[model samples]
Target chain A: MFSLLLQSFVCCRFLSSLWLSQHSVVCLLLQVLLTHITISNSQHNTPNPTMMKSIVARAYSPFCSVFATEDCDKLANDLGYEDLITLLAPHGDSVGRATVRDSQGMTNTYDDFAIRLGAKRPTERDSGGMLFNPDAMEALLREYIGHYNSDDSAFARFFAKLVAAPPDTAFETFSQPAAHLFCVSSRNAHPLDTLQALAQGQKRDKDCLNFYVLVHDARVEDAENSTQRTIALLERAKKRFGLAGMIKLGQEGVPETIPTPQFLTVGDELVNLKTGVGFGSRTLSQPDKESIRSLLREFTVQHLIPHMERCIMTWDTVAAGKRGLTGRMFSAGKKWLKFGGSEKQEAGSSIQASGIYPQGSPEQTIRRLADYAFMLRDYRYAYATYELVKRDFLSDKAWKYLAACQEQAAVALLMYTTRLTEKQRVEVLNPLLDSACYTYISRLQLPQYALRMLVVTSDLQCLLGPDAASQGATQWFQKLLDERLVGRLGYALIMLRVSYAFSQSPKGRKAALWQLLSAREWADANQKGEMAKCLDMTAPVYDELNWPNNEGTLLTRLKGELANEAKPTSVAS
Target chain B: MSYYLAIVGTEDNPIYTQEFGTYRQGGDGNSRFSPEMKELAPFILHAAIDMVEQTASRTNQLYLRTVDNFYSHLVSAFVTAGDIKIMLLHETRNEESIRQFFQEVHDLYVKTLLSPFYFVNQPITSPVFDQRIKSLAKKYL
Candidate 1:
């Protein structure tokens, strides 16, 4: 019986070992299959149409994807690879195609899928999720680049948007060939890289690779490339990528270089390149001219206006002496003057006459008509003028003027809220806001404006409340504040004002507490007397609430007590 | 045709006034208002100011109709958004002629408005404005 049991045990051990081997093999095969499935699925799936549409809308073009070999085979079979090649080939060039093909072959693998599986995926990046979802990328590429002709301004704008940042991961997934092509052709190595580069440079470049290189050089003194090498690269980018505008090649040789006044001075050369005449005619038909102008207008109407308005509002509180119509008119007038051209003569003439040099000359007139229009309390004329100026400035590539115009446009839109339809609000306000945020975060020479814009954005977010959509904006502002682009004091004041306006019901007090705390902290800093005064004005409201005796409570009490003693009630009796 | 024009200030005070005639083809360059019309010129001009205000309020633009007529004389007004009105009363053949006449007057009004010496809704008493208006009438009429 013992011998029989030992034999049975040995048999059981042998069977168990064999079963373990089989199970291991199956698991390995399953892993392989899963990776292959993911690769194939990614290859088959395309980019999100909405994202692609946004890219297209921004770029103003249909963008083709560079498909991986397997995906290419599938797409080729379905859409004809030769036709696809022909479609994207011209943009690629023979050298570009060869380089792209070589790069694709070098990088091609199912390893990316395996790696993706290994890591926890980010739920979303910015407004969307999964930077590179192959199917979504493909679909997006098709939608973005499909119907539109290459030369369309829409295509240019879309391309500009894509090249403005890094090539997205969706861009990477959908078309390896196209991705490779963009990598070689544009300055940005990738989308995230582009965003990082843009963040560093404080400006967007439509030429991806070249912009990346230029900005890299601008930011990092110890970067591998020499100044001459950087300049050569920029020249190559200028020639090969058709890069427009002024590119700084020389070195002050510092990592994280603050842009010099010379950068703004470069506007003249850019303007000349755009208009072909130095401040001669108000319009230009050249594509680069138009693109630059549109960009400027977008920047100004969206970014600069809000800053100026905030500046005005801040001035209203701080510099109350300058709050008259003439001063307001003067500030707005300066913006219009920058754009060139006259509306009503007094509008322009008065500006000129004020001894405040218009954009071109000290003697030139800055019109008051635009100011009147902007301040008319009816926004139709203001909106129209803003649109016109935006279009004209964008076409002209008048960078300074464009920036100013976009800033003004934002303020006008915000102030004239009743005039905009829902669709118009979304269409106009979103771009304006985006542009403003972009400019401010980019840190282009309007620091005060940037600070003011952060306030506006914060206000808008508060107004919108805490929705999933707004959460992104809230995060954006948080990030902005975190970066110290906006000082705590400024951010707190704007937040206080926005919260006060948005808080309607009883919950408003709760909502206002955070702002009140921020305001109290700002008041404590107490550098600016006027800001302190404004804080003093708001303290009574917090005091009336009579909450816990924290720092917020103490500050409120002190301020409220002081205010009460300052004013005595007048009785008719 | 004789012309009587007045620029009224913000306070409805007369800032400037000019009287002239068509210095064009076969027309004498003389004021041709009837004695009574001439006597009533300021009142006529003042009345036109009321019409301008009413028209501007309604339309948000400042083109008033022929507000007053005195013995074949027609007074037409063009007011700017700033409440500055250019009132032109002319003795002309018909509506079409008067319309052409006013069109010229409008151009002169814009040119005058462009002048730094003039403020919106203020009396335009500048000699240069008067000379320009006289020249515009001669050239267009």
Candidate 2:
């Protein structure tokens, strides 16, 4: 109702102006808009430096699995693998220093090569479980890539949304952990036996690097005893697991290390939103921090980086073999034969039967290869791999898999390429994102994924030298509203986003109009704060047009409602 | 098909208005617009003027096909030299016929403007003009 009134009012104002006068106004508006554009362009109009840095930091981090037996919890006084890892883990800048050569043979030193340590490896349980779902992945990706909250440009927010992974049933964006840490407490009587048992339980892919961690509590146990036991356990693990034989470790450098857990008191029920940790910041002793740091650094430099480098080399060759002309023909022939052999097998079964690609298949290998390249920050290679595999998924009609590939492919390109030409944006990012969002919403019944997709895509778009892309971003936001995919609060929020998008566009009045509409939406959603904010933003525009009295009643009523909301005792009849 | 046509002058005053149903396919030449739509169609055309003006700036073509829409009702427009807008609020899109209708109406409008008694922004109350419009609606609508 408010929008209808506002629209008519705006239309009437527009209608009253003669074409000659309006044309002159449009020309003046364009000149002012062009001046603003020139100023922004002169300021090195790339994405925010911090945002790019954070995206690189997040995307390049390797994943590792920390496996602790149930006995480790008993030793740590009910502190499970998560708490123990948290206490002994080196996070962010504390991960010490590591020097490694990438697959491209460029030597780079990282003082903070951090690995995201998950408690367990990806299992069938995680596939069906609520944890680590597509929405969760999208949220986590947004956090890592950089939050879009501070960006004023609507395209920046949209780009952030576009480049993040779409919700997929198969969790493949973050690669399967390349390094597995088997952690055992010294208090456990048969630590070696538990390590052996746990190691045996794993499907022990040959490429994965296994590290044995002996965790001891400084407050409870003797550090020397734990170190000696760790040495003995390493010898046993070397004999039983054959990790030493596999990697050909030198006698001077043992894979096993003792990390003494330092106690820190943190309030329960408090979480660090940024890190998504169970507890907030707790200061650690400098030496303890250094010890954990050096341990992780050694783990990354000696085992993790080298292993990843080797894997990339091997996968590159294998991918070249498979994706090359002959390999493509061979695969095409194989697929054709399969198509002829199974006349009754519908395309849907390919997705339903193998929720993920069948193990050891070319698609799985390529995806794994892409994941590793992404982890290694070889984004070009990762983007190419994603592009290569996207077609296979498309032909198989694996919509979810195809969408995931498309999302990752776009993200990889966005992360690596600093600037995209108009042609690339239209040809590459646009179609990839459109298909991904469409498939997520239509093929799959995951509107949440579509929302995330649009949100991320808009953020990524904002990064690419803001221009008419904001208009495209606004259209996507409008689509979210039109589809009714968002809740009332989300609707109000996205409407404000649309307003912001328009505000960044050349047309100032359209921005004011959207702001008015957004204010109405906020009022409808009963969000007094946001409604007041939007009204405040639109105030100057209305004042310019002398429309205060025309909108005064609605604004006064809304302000009154806000005042009532602020008070404690406002009961409605 | 139901259509509501309005001839709005440069100052956005309604100079002429008509409503009619399709005369083809066994239909009587009477408007079948819903009572709610009958009340709303004028406002719809009024609201669409903003869109018409915006579209007019982007293109040189006088016939701005379907400038705006309110749900299923599309507003097609034709602009004259003096900035008089002839807007049609219609249910179905008949681009060529509407373009032809707008062209013939433009001729009639020019003839009306050329009259010594007629003036710009003056309402058309001539019965002969009304009869010609009804006949045109029957011939091509």
Candidate 3:
């Protein structure tokens, strides 16, 4: 049994060895197959599988079994089957066969296949989706619309782009949300050509451009024809585009010195726009008749007539002083006269003239008339008109005009006193003077007018001296200077006048000198640089004369005072 | 339609022309022109130009209808605010149908002036224009 067992053991060893070797071979083959499968899966499962497939397809022939046997199910899962289908739908023919197969015969639904191809969709493999970001859309729209520079074409482009865009996009992009695409061109091009181009462009594309053409300096065949043409154009534009679009036919720069009637006529034409004539300060300095007429016409046609009456009424007080009842009646009466009726007959007639005037109420008429009278050179009439209107318009334009007229009339009466007797002088002149002074010192509305009145008042007081008759005027002048209603120049003039008055008085020499010294100092302090230079040039002569004892010393002190006068560093607030 | 055409020069001078007709469905092109329309043609044209200029600068545009009437004659303007217009006013046999006639006249006007020789606001006294006007009246009236 031992020998037999030994022989069987030898046989068993050989069988076992054979079995072990075969098992090893089988395991090795199985290991190789599994490794191959794993390698294939890894290659297919790589990031950007599409790119890798494209590369593999490019490198190998069409019959490459390696691609043929690709586990498309796994690949589809890795690459996002839905995304691939969406991407290939528009460009299935362009995509590789393997990709097309992987996409399950899906087709792009978008009309723009190229656009679809360019588009990217979010996938497990992709970090970000191909969908447009809100921020990026905003940036793009901003860049596009922000290019507007108000040029006609640029404006059209901007408008076209804006309206063509989604409403939400447009609102988010523009600061002015309601800005239209209309444009005005100041160039020398035919407006018709521009309009045709714009119309054609807009027609070609339903959402292309909405355009309005403006012809700058468009020359009309003639004035009458041109105005008619302009009206026609406006009407057409209105009908076509409502008020949203317009073409302005702007006449270029007109001559500054046109005739008064012509200027007035132009002003009347432009009155509809209510654009006031722009006269700079320099223009105001040398205002010609045409300029004044233009100004007046604009004021009347645009502001005054539309709000006031067709006729301006003024009560001529100075004329009233001479002509009595007739002057006052004519001055104030004509204002109330109806356009087509006699003054007496139209006394109670309706103020409203159907087409003649709109706001021809008595108050408006009186106010306008007062303004007209105030601007007139004849102070007598102006004063009367103002007085007539004053009771109605207290402490306003009418009151101010009345005061001015009164003051001016007083000055005139004083200047021409040869015809007046002492009684008349005392009766008319004194009251007039008092009224003038009171108005200047108390109710002077405008600074320039106040300054003028103050100068005249001081001069009159100086001429009258320190008598009881001049006491009221003197006190008023002093008060006015102290109040500073008048500026530094007025103050100096007042001081000089006071000094002269005191010097003329008996036993007033010492007071006169004090006043004169004060005047000199004020004058010196306020002297303009050019005026100071002139004074410096004349100083030596005054000093050499020495009409007053130590006058040279005083004059020198005046010069010193002038030198001490600081150059004004700040303007009045 | 009694048409009053005026060319207002830049200097406010008015050059006026007029024609009267009612071009409508199965109606005779010739209509009795009112003497008032003829007499007031210049004034009507001038006023239309004035109204146009006045309204052109405004932010609104609407044809001012029957601005002035002189005893059975009315003045109306279709302003372009840059070119001349043919204003029309007449006692229409049928007021409602006048709009269609007016539109036809306007189209003919626009077409006739399409030639370069015909400048804006120029008097339309051409025989060709007259023929076209007559033809348009025949077609529409």
Candidate 4:
């Protein structure tokens, strides 16, 4: 989900190779699934499990749902508010900087900071607290994306929903938006009225940032006219909605009005959804690009960052106040164990029998705080906060929450720590990933999540450098194979990667053997090009080696298969 | 118990291969592998050779127990001197007895190697060697 140009140095280096390799597979699978999409409008039905898996995997980015009043929504119907943000975010030359106070009360700055935006269409108003249903929401999204399955019978539909949704509580918690962008289009006649109604209607909450953007169209009106209109709207907004009061409370910030020449540009493909709605893409001039970038930079710097900083402070204080002195001491003691502690000894913090951490409870607050810190790119603080909540989730026997915390904790460490020392790798990252992977795969039976976790962790490990790191990576790749988590193409791709990981390590013969295995898998998958490439890669090691006759025959037959592939395509036997 | 045993030479060449069944606990000794499993067994064992070599390098022990598994079938291995591996693909795990069986096979393998007519990496065609292995499976596996 990361924009290649805007990603942090560490993230770019860590993700580039893995992302490149996975890009083809993910796209190919999506293409295959999209072809199967049936756009029938039948009665309510549960999503297909495999279809849900693919959809869930695609929605891994941090979501920021865009909201607007009816008039603004109608005005920008061609280019939805969310789609506008998505299109502009990647094309910008720079999004500038943000300096925020982390959970540990340390200030950190990120240059060229950007959010990996997803086009999360606005839904009904979130009932103002922690009980957002990610499955229902994602199901809605799946429907929007044309993955709705109408063939499922009513009872089967009910049972499928019952089985699939509840166990994946981690994903539910993650689907909580980092921020919500409310828009008041310049085209709307009563912009001030719409803004006031949206501001008042949106329940003022401390959990997520709710910032406003005045979407101006330069093609309709000049920038000076729109800016004058925006100022007038803000003046009226201050008096009507008491925006100045919200700004003082750190709950809101100054509104931004951004202009675009046109939503659609030349040579852009029109995206047709299941609803038969088509959204246009735009080409931007340099000034338009700069204004869009400036808008984001201003929003992130002035509103989102400050909002998160204030919330972290608020949540930390609330959690600390609830915890009291002895609880603080107990948490400090627990922190000692967090560094190098074994899994068995982490059962110290106990929760009551009810098992639910209420919306504003210290545990829930800290969890939200962690999520915010992660979204804000304050990884160190996020890591610490996640580690803190993990114990509470563990003691409460909340497998989904615990697994999500562990997964985030590992990711935070990878992102924040400049260099991953062997000690940290063994003590911290390994156990976190292992426990998370176990919970996701075994307890939740969410192999898709487990696959994602291992793939990301292994790639991060490989990026940390060769030797022990690459060896660790190879081991994780082997786990993917052992678990049989991927399809045939995925299996072949993983084998090819494992070979590369081995080659990165000092194990030459093992590397060559893995190349051979990869070639064989590719052949099985009927990917003759990849099969030929893998065979060629292993040739240096196996071609003239004094090995047995069988290996020799394997190479010969693989070459024969490639030769046959050239003659005419036959089914892989 | 169904078993597929292969002795792999240093260069990953199979020197000897056999498929047999347990003659213990009122059971007759007859290989019970399904047709698909029989065809897949070679690939499984061959794949485990990578694990065997990797594990063999890490430990000084002759018996590298249960190096890898595919489905319900477990691949237990024993490494002899000169990097040759004795691998057994079987269902269910009886670790101590498997170790004892492997040690006995190691003895037979060594004895076979000591014979003047035999050489390393050559397929074992001796009827006597096959008879001894079946008897060993009957006693221990």
Cα lDDT for residue B128, candidate 2: 95
Q: Per-residue CA lDDT of candidate 3, range A230-295, in tens?
A: 456646765665432222222344323221111111222133123322121111112222322332
Docking class of 1: incorrect
List of clashing residue pairs for candidate 4: none
TM-scores for all predictions: 0.23, 0.65, 0.27, 0.64
- In CAPRI terms, model 2 is classed as incorrect
Give the alpha carbon lDDT tens digit for every residue of A195-296 in model 4. 667666766655766666666555453656766766676676656643221110001233334332111111111133323333223333455445556766
**To one decimal, what is the Cα RMSD in angstroms of model 4 from the true structure?**
14.2
Question: What's the distance in Å from true for residue A256, model 1?
Answer: 55
Of 1 and 2, the candidate ranking higher by lDDT? 2
By summed lDDT, the worst window of 10 consecutive residues in model 2 chain A runs over A261-270
Per-residue lDDT of A219 in model 4: 46
For B36-138, candidate 4 gives per-residue lDDT tens digits of 5665566567667767877888998999999986657899999998678899999988899999999999999889889998888888989999999999998
Candidate with maximal lDDT: 2
True contacts kept of each: 0.00, 0.00, 0.00, 0.07
Q: What is every candidate's C-alpha DockQ against the true complex, given to 2 decimals?
A: 0.01, 0.12, 0.00, 0.21
